[model samples]
Target: MRPSSTLLLVLGLSSTLTACGGEARSQASASPVVETTVAEPQYESIEQFESAAIKRDVPYVPTPQETVDEMLRLAQVSRDDLVYDLGSGDGRIVITAAKKHGARGVGIDIDPTRIEEANENARTAGVTDKVKFVQGDLFNADLGQATAVTLYLLRSVNLRLRPKLLAELRPGTPVVSHDFDMGEWAPDDHKRVGDDDIYLWIVPAKVDGNWQWKDAAGRSIVATIEQEFQTFTGTARADGDRYNLRNGRINGAEVSFELVRAGDETAPVLERYAGKLANGAIQGRITAGNRQAAWLAKHD
Candidate 1:
């Protein structure tokens, strides 16, 4: 298969910020209207469905009610939040977000049939005014208005949309995914809702720079990170040798990614670091050779 297009693999959180000359709307404003798109049922199985959902291009299964409630519990949605449900299916998430959390919501789906079902569901739930379902591609939807986001997409799709979501939404926006994992990035919290797992991630503020860490051996390793908004490039330097590090964008208040180093002739063959970043500190599993250690990163 062809490598996923950045656009095809990712959900396009509305990057049409005022800076991009998108229709000027109040900051943190939640539109009372529900926005959605024409529908075309593309998949039947959960796996096939989510795979399409992640690309922000295909239609998939609607979120179950139990899952919606679980997302609310995890996100702690409130009246002030603007929630967006990508691949809204039957609008369960958006409607519930409005009904229970008192938050306004927008649901986007490619299937017009699903949009109709969502609208009816919103009305039946007495949340029509607060929730609206539009017929459109999630890839083309404007997610910047959302303070909270709920998804039931695929892992690859989540990874693809990862950068766009971070770039558009401000730090602290809550993102909840039902069954999908945001590759490379870590979630702040997660819980099991019945047999399913829900992951919650918060967008972190932009504060990327070079950081140096010292081991107990008195040897210092410096990591130079260049952040482009949320996406980043990092290199680790120890002694005279340099190594490339794997890194992912921040989702909300948390930063979770991976780092790896290959050994030279004189050195061992493998070194790996994986963990979460919070409050200027990094903590997680660090592996070098057969030994594993804890790691931390604090502000300079």
Candidate 2:
């Protein structure tokens, strides 16, 4: 049967629409569903995290401003002094030293956050020119250039750091600690600020050996010194006569002691010897009553 053109056109259009609809249904039915997933967070061990984090020997504790001022005072911080504040939390100690005492200062801290905070504080205090902040472990810091040091660390930390302080700092350098002290290493001075305790120590010179010098009367004097920290005991021999040292003390490079002639209980002859130690030699004066004379000593 021959169909009309209009009917044929209609038939073709209908077939095309049906085919398109069927293909669209087939595509929709054959489509695969998509599923969503969330990942779980992974955490490392506490020790591993701590190793990656900032290592602090002592916890961060801000020193009171009053205590800071007292610490600087106890250390006798001057404009010529280069003060170092170890374990500086917000750099208050060093900043206070620079601002109040017109001194130069360095602050060492392990935490970067604290280092940043301290730097900002120094800037605000207008002492940036005289102060600097360093992010590092205090134990590993170089303190040779420091004339004074301040600490607000734990007792254990202070004990652990005592050797480094004594080794690096020059003799006569003053060290001040807030609320904690070096075990068995007595403080040269101590003061109370409110409820906080401030302790000071002067680095002692190494003068524990034989020292020889000439007395006022052209007599040769030989001294044997045995020192434990700043206090010492020894005996001096001159002209075949032995004298026992009394009240022997060393403060930095300054050494002083009194000599009393041995075997003389009553009416003992007393001589006071005072000297400054440098280049392994002592240049000082001996005072016997109203008379004073020059004295020189060399470590042997």
Candidate 3:
């Protein structure tokens, strides 16, 4: 797995539902101390058979050819996007993404045969120069350069990958999925593709850091909050009482969010504020009770 990247955009990404890897072999105390080798499961093609086993979802349906085309359209994948297809069945999505959109793609699947087949398919589609396939655990795959993602996995698996998807991919990167919906998380846009509904989500930027603000009374407030990807729980004390700030998002150079004075819901400070980060400081305007003020911020 690659290191997590930054989510620097907020396009009001659909909120996702709440949801690591190591390989080791242990010796068994059996007859004659035999060195038993347990081989990892491998498959030639990730067709419905293997997919059902890994995903444990029977009767999995592959995206229809026309549906794939529509998904590419909905995702807005262009010549600039690096599309990554998880559980790539036959590399159809990746091949089509590169061939039709002039984009690049990487297909990750656990079946070596599928990888080889995908590579061959790409060559046949005349997009081999732009599409590549890797045989490995999708959970361990690197998604550092992915500008867009397409998936046809189960809801549980989708939910499990939510954090990694948000933490690794840059904010605003579009994700397209077929049929099944991500639990609790609504899609930014959804449309019917033939008889199926395709969903799209733009990843929201991570919100954390030092920001400066000024109240309508001309009082300056510089607050710093440490963050962990999507959700941030930080404290910014004011007037002898600690104010708890929650929910923040950083989109490119702009940062906007909410905060409460201390932990008390009734004691509110600056209900909402919007600001932008420039150079090494945060400067923006705040709105509260028909009051507006400009604030400046520097890293603490």
Candidate 4:
């Protein structure tokens, strides 16, 4: 079969997707898919036909209504949120976001037919003003303005889109995907809804800098952080000795780290740093050697 005009446009634009300068690329999912390009019609009553305008390479698979609700619920959509539904088959996720949560939504699908179906659904749901659908490549969709994103694409597609997602979306944006995961990005929360897996990840704030402050005990503490997306690997200096930090976690403004080393009091004195990074400083509490103290750090 000759390639569709839309598909050609999408492939032509894939090279610049990471920049997110414009609308979609060529391919979008048009129907529910199993392991391949075959359609497994799950909703014959609502959508009688799966349009043959398969926009993207992935087989079409429309998420069940129950799963759609769970995905949006996990993302905590609100009136203030701008939700983006990638590879949006039939536009169920975006429509639900606008109808149930009162949030504005954009659904991107490669198949023009699917986009039409989505717009029809949105009109029926009385969310036509708040929800819009686009026909383009999900990878090429500009997601910088979105506060929440929903996906039902394949595992490879999720992994491929991971970097752009991390880089384009701002901190604290929650991404909820149904069935597939972002490989190494590690979800902050996940749950199974009726045999379907839903994953949620919140973008972490940038906190990679040198910080220093005095403890409640008048002890000087200095620390350095090396950040990777939402997590960090770093070291802290205390009392003329440097200690390695383990289990460092950075969730948005929240931060925590631990240190364990041999000491006269215990086999290994465990020091825990639980704090928040904000306004160019870190402030929280620390526990070391059976003593608790207020922790504070400043970063320029």
User: Best by TM-score, which number?
Assistant: 2
Per-residue accuracy of model 1 over 174-199 as CA lDDT, tens digit each: 88988777766767788876656788
Q: lDDT of each prediction vs. the true structure? A: 0.71, 0.85, 0.71, 0.78
Cα distance off (Å), candidate 4, residue 214: 3.5
**Best-to-worst lDDT order:** 2, 4, 1, 3
- TM-scores for all candidates? 0.55, 0.79, 0.64, 0.72
- Count backbone clashes in candidate 2: 0
- List clashing residue pairs in candidate 2: none
Q: Write the per-residue lDDT of candidate 2 for residues 143-258, one digit (tens) a residue.
A: 99999999888777889998899889999999998887788888999998876788899999989999898877778999999987788888889989998887889999999988
- Please identify which of the two predictions, 3 or 4, would achieve the higher lDDT against the true structure: 4
- Worst lDDT 10-window in candidate 3: 2-11
Span of 10 residues, lowest total lDDT, candidate 4: 1-10
Model 3, TM vs. native? 0.64
Q: Name model 4 segments beyond 4 Å from true.
A: 1-57, 216-220, 261-271, 287-300
Report the C-alpha lDDT of model 4 over 1-300, residue by residue, as the tens digit.
112223234445665674463332222334335234546756443323444535466656688899899999999999999999998879999999998999999999887778888988988999999988988888888999999999887677888998898779877899998877777788899988776788899988778888787754676867778887677877677798776666788887788877654232243636778888777777899887789988887884
Evaluated at residue 164, the lDDT of candidate 3 is 82
Best by lDDT: 2
Task: Give model 1's TM-score versus the native structure.
Answer: 0.55
